[model samples]
Target: MAKLIRSIVVSAPSGTGKSTICRRLLAACPDIKFSVSLTSRTPRPNEINGKDYHFISHEDFQRRIDEGEFVEWVENYGQFYGTSVKVINDALNHGKDLLLDIEPRGAKAIKKQFPDAVFVFVLPPSPDELLKRLKKRGHESEEAIKIRFSQSNSELKEVLWYDYTIFNEDLETAVFQMISIYHAEKCKTNRLCGKIDRVFKI
Candidate 1:
């Protein structure tokens, strides 16, 4: 009668609002759990150790890589980041849906390991609009923004591989679309025996 947990990976280019949507989704849907990633980058001024990211030295990250603890690892903008296979397996084993907000490359890696995992790619309504939003943030220099834009192109190229591509023009609308997907995934026959039994219940 209970819903089985599914692992869903959400990937997007920078400024696609994946983080905000993920946070809102968790707040709106209590049963969903996020995959907290480990990074070799330093924690930002406002970031906490575990909540924002598990910051570690390059040496430790390499050690983890050698240990084969991560499901997938990537080096982006001179920093390393990865999602742990153990973390995902533990959450799913406990009947909690696991949501991973990762890069396209990482998403591809996770997909290879977990064939049934759902992949969602979030995109801005238009590339121009995306550029505008990135500029408005004013957090990075022009060079940095350009580099991110380049990566966005790379991320967009892999959109066809995803199961769903949501245009995040409006935050609320996008979140609702994702919610609909999450609910639909829960109703899968493999996840819901109750639904199968309901027809004969009468």
Candidate 2:
């Protein structure tokens, strides 16, 4: 009997430090696999293709979308982002715990297809704090920052539907909470059912 495999989808508004928390969790748990998403946007400095994202042209992205190659996809800030259906199936087939860092729209799309998957949201302590963090990035224009700030407000409302939420006031504490959530999810009845059945048969 094969045990159930689950994917964890996590999201946070930009500048909330969600990616840092995810990286820490991955470092702490080597067995978990991060699902690198496909994007039509150009890679930022230090971002590696296939590692950070599968960077592709807009035409290529739209072609895949037309072919139904993605489990979920969305266009944001004029860039396309998507998760391939193969990526999810491959990880589950190999018994890996898949982790996805995506936006609220993509996460909601995933939830429909993967009802058993755990959904988590990372949030800033306050709107003011989030704005401050966005400014500290030192790259975006003021208008860009304002747009993201508005988007964050909209995304924050989506948190109410998530399975769990973590406050990112402190990185260490947030990571601890995320890891703990992972451990707890691993022990859910749906996940353990196959093993329990096998033990009884023995």
Candidate with maximal lDDT: 2
> What pairs collide in candidate 1?
none
CA lDDT of 134 in candidate 1? 87
* Candidate 1 RMSD computed on C-alpha atoms after optimal superposition onto the true structure: 2.0
lDDT of 2 by residue, 38-114 (tens): 99999887889999899999999999999999999998888999999998888877878899999999999999988
Give the alpha-carbon lDDT of every model: 0.88, 0.91
| Lowest-sum lDDT 10-residue window in model 2 | 1-10
The whole-model C-alpha lDDT of candidate 2 against the native structure comes to 0.91
Candidate achieving the largest TM-score: 2
Cα error, residue 183 of model 2, in Å, equals: 0.4
Please give the clash total of every predicted structure, in order. Answer: 0, 0
Whole-structure CA lDDT of model 1: 0.88
Question: Each prediction's TM-score against the native?
Answer: 0.92, 0.95
Q: Residue 34 in candidate 2 has what lDDT?
A: 90
